[model samples]
Target: MTQTWLITGASSGLGTALALAALRAGHKVLATARNPTKAAQENPQIEELGGIWISLDVTSPDTAKHVTDAITTAGGTIDVVVNNAGYSLLGSIEDMSENEIETQFSTNVYGPVRILKGILPFMRAQRSGTVVNISSSAGVDGAPSCAMYAGSKFAVEGMSESLSKELQPFGIRVILVEPGYFRTKFFAAFVAPAAGLTEDYVGTPVEAALKAIKAKDGSQEGDPVKAAQRILEVVTSRGLGAGTEGFLRVPLGQDCYNRFQTKIDTLQANLTKMKEIAHSTGFDS
Candidate 1:
């Protein structure tokens, strides 16, 4: 079956891979970036594969309007929407400025919210659609120097979970793609604190985290093309995701799987350990 896919941040990385994959699969792709001219120039293969590029900056307040307009120009129906435009803010929470934090949330959290607002009405009217949110393993398990990024992804995770339930009656599916490190320009593009590392963070986990991120930039084990293919499979209910339509989240790498499992284990242990205390908190009944 052919479908129309709206993928944000399609200038590079996973977004570009997904656009190409969908186009090759006979789907119409509306790939969006802040500057479609630059994006097209950078990834001519998208156009070569029959994908169309549109201008859309997730940080802009006009995100909803722009997406809606694009959809209208693309034949009035959308099958899938992928919110993939986001950046990481790496630094201790104290080291980050208010502007930096706000910018992070604006792009990572609010961008998807705007997209949902624009797309949900149409999906509800049609009674069918899929919303894929590109989150991170850090969303499930936070680490030092990743507070802002993790917080933003965590917000997306929570929103998607609730949205899945809310849109179930309308036959809309929400999938959170919690990917681990993939070999992309993500690390290279990550925003660090303008002030740089503070003296308090010297020789601390924050410093070590920064070093590890720099070291892992191009060496990340996961492949964006593979990840994009998997996502397409899951969305289309073919290949690896056959007969798995009911799943809500797809963690894409060994590192992500390990982190998710560790978080689950920790939660279970905490619940068991705090059961009595939790019970004690209840009012007399």
Candidate 2:
């Protein structure tokens, strides 16, 4: 069955890769970017493969309306919506300015919220759809110099979890894709603190993390093409995702798997250790 997919931030990275993958799989793609002209210029294959580029800036207050308009223009039915437009703001908590943090959340967190508000009505009425939110490994485990970025992704994870349950009865599926260090312009595009690294962070983990990130910019282990293909397969229940239904989260890359495992282990350990203490908070019934 051919489905229509609406993908944000399709100008580059995993968004562009997913658009191409879906197009090759015979699906109609509504690829959106902040600048469709430039996006088209950068990714001519999308147009060649029958993908339509729509202009959408997720950070804008009118994002929900724009999404609704785009859906209406695309024949009023959307099967898959990928909220993939986001960028990282890398810095220490104190180093980041208020505007920087707000911008990060606006793009990474609120962007998806607006998209959901626009598409939920249609999906509910249709009683079928998939919402794929692209999170990050940092979302599962925080790291130095990534407080703001991790916070944004954590918000995504939390919302997606609740949304999955909320939409289950409506036959709508929500998936959070937590990818780790994919070989995209993601690393290269990260914004640093506007105030620059303060002397307090000169020799701290923040500096080390920044250096490590720079070193890994173009040498990330994960492949965006393969990741995109996997996402498509998961949504359509083909390839590796065959027979895998009722899965809420898809953690991409070995790094992501490792991080998730670590988090699970830590949580289990804490639960066991604090069982009595946790129970003590409740009053006798």
Q: Write the per-residue lDDT of candidate 1 for residues 1-285, one digit (tens) a residue.
A: 899999999999999999999999999999999889999999999998889898888888888888889899989999999999999999988989999999999999999999888898889999999999999999899998999999999999999899999999999999999999999999999999998888989899989999999999999999999999999999999999898799999999999998889999999999999999988986798
Clashing pairs in 1: none
**TM-score of each predicted structure versus truth:** 0.98, 0.98
TM-score of candidate 2 against the unseen true structure: 0.98
Candidate 1, residue 200: the lDDT equals 89
- For each candidate, the alpha-carbon lDDT, in order, equals 0.94, 0.94
In Å, residue 179's CA in model 2 sits off its true spot by: 0.3
**Model 2 regions lying over 4 Å from their true place:** none
